[model samples]
Target: GARHGINMNGKLQRLQEQEERIFSSSCENLVEQIIEKKKKKKRKTIETDE
Candidate 1:
């Protein structure tokens, strides 16, 4: 019973790590998009002020 429990724990840990990696990569793309949107907004405001 202890051996089976350890095996399940390892599998769960690996799955968690994989999910984290996927989330982090997707998060980077989201951050980049947000930055781009902010830059665009700033440019528009500058143009309007001019």
Candidate 2:
């Protein structure tokens, strides 16, 4: 029983790590998208000014 408990804990830990990695990668993608959008907006404003 103790061994089983240990195994379960390890599995849970691994799953948590995986989730954290996915969450961080998705956050980075969101940041990149926002930056791209800002750049596009700046270009539009510059073009209009000219």
Candidate 3:
């Protein structure tokens, strides 16, 4: 029973780590998208100014 408990804990820890990695990567992607949108907006403004 103790061994089973240890195994379960290990599995849970691995799952948490995987989730964190996925979350961080998704956050980075979101930031990149926002930056791209901002760049596009700036380009549009510049073109309008000229």
Candidate 4:
């Protein structure tokens, strides 16, 4: 039972780490997309003004 509990704990920790990594990457991707969108809008506005 002790060995089983240790194994389960290890697996749980690994799963938690994987989830955190995935969540962070998705957030980074979302932020990058938003930045790109803002840059594009700014460029378009500048071109229109000129």
Q: Which prediction has the highest TM-score against the true structure?
A: 4
Q: Over the stretch 1-50, how does candidate 2's per-residue lDDT look in tens digits?
A: 99999999999999999999999999999999999999999999999999
Per-candidate Cα lDDT values, in order, are 1.00, 1.00, 1.00, 1.00
* Clash count for each candidate, listed in order shown: 0, 0, 0, 0
In candidate 4, what are the lDDT values of residues 1-50, reduced to their tens digit?
99999999999999999999999999999999999999999999999999
User: Model 3: per-residue lDDT, tens digit, 1-50?
Assistant: 99999999999999999999999999999999999999999999999999
Runs in model 3 deviating more than 4 A are none
Model 4, stretches more than 4 Å misplaced?
Answer: none
Per-residue error for 6 in candidate 4, Å, reads: 0.7
User: For candidate 1, what is the TM-score?
Assistant: 0.67
- State TM-scores per candidate: 0.67, 0.93, 0.94, 0.97
Worst 10 contiguous positions by lDDT, candidate 3: 1-10
